[model samples]
Target: MQALLFEPNVQRIADETTGPITYQPGVIAPDLAASWFAALLQGVDWHESSRMMYERMVGVPRLHGHYAADDPSLPKVLGAALGIAKAQFRAPFNSIGLNFYRDEHDSVAPHNDKLHELVPHQPIVLLSLGATRTMVIRRKTPPHLKTELELEAGSLLLMGWNAQLNYDHGIPKLRYPVGPRISVAFRVRPGWSEDGW
Candidate 1:
């Protein structure tokens, strides 16, 4: 994405007691985002896993990476990201969840972040890098409202803790070939101690 030339598409999808579910584009410049993406693509410890699907165990479509906010081994770029997120929402975010989509073949199943694993009332911040992908967020109740946003590199998406209670979001596999993408998710985890923000 051409961050400087790009027009900001900020949308507040919902307003809840905890916070607002919103998407803000071009939070980082394209040059900085490109460097960070390239470094993180090789820097983070990526993991692959499997999950039970239809009574059978199958590989998760995308790779995952996770880290505590205090760990000294985390990539420096992440610290920079944490500062941006903290400045934006001032929540004590202490966990990082990274999703790596290698290509259009990689995707994530529709689901919400586990409540038991997160701190109440804190918003979840996700920073996108690499290729753009559409994320579908659909409400759980009647009418099942659905919204789609093309998450481009350097954009930031903030979903309130309450939003998870009301919606499920996911990235479905695309038919056309696409490059890799990485999503850096910052959250506040219950009972976790962090040395820095």
Candidate 2:
């Protein structure tokens, strides 16, 4: 197998008080990205998501799916992809979450990953597939520093363990047309399975 490579111009979006947020473009081989994207789109059991906003429930603009560690039910392609990520990152990832952005309108609100669930100091690895989209990260406190990044297909983002402490990240809605995209986030949660939490 050929070794995976990242773009030379890796960007670090962080400051003195916050943990590192590194973006490595082209982490997946370009030749394989197309096929992998297609397989995941068809294989994962994706569904619309919603959450309580203010006093009312609102539908999230994207689709979502999840795979627990050692889940035998995952499709072969997704399982293989998970294996690759685990080997590449060398993290004890216990869960995987998939977010599908069907078009330019799908977006996620700025927020940090829930820290109570994740094991501290373990980086979260996010792999991007399909269309490129912009991700924004902003400081949670005064000064309110911010940065924007174009998350390209086949890219990988490593969010440091402490990155969540001071910053919030999200994918904002775009007005222009964009094809579908998928992001797979690998994490090491405290629980063994979804039910354990």
Best by TM-score: 1
In the range 44-126, model 2's lDDT, one tens digit per residue, is 89998778989999999999999886787876766766787788768888888999999999999899998988898888989
Whole-model lDDT, candidate 2? 0.85
Best model per lDDT? 1
Off by over 4 Å in 1: 1-9, 17-19, 194-197
Candidate 1 lDDT tens digits, 1-197: 33343456678877775246899988889898999999999999899999998999999999999888889898899988998889877998899899999999999989999998888888899999999999999888878888898998999999998998899999999999999999999999988865643
Error of 1 at 77 (Å): 0.4
Cα deviation at 183, candidate 1, in Å, is 0.4
* Full-model lDDT, candidate 1: 0.89
Q: What's the TM for model 2?
A: 0.91
Per-candidate alpha-carbon RMSD to the true structure: 2.9, 2.2
**Model 1 weakest lDDT span, ten residues long:** 1-10
Note the Cα lDDT for every prediction shown.
0.89, 0.85
Worst 10 residues of 2 by lDDT: 1-10
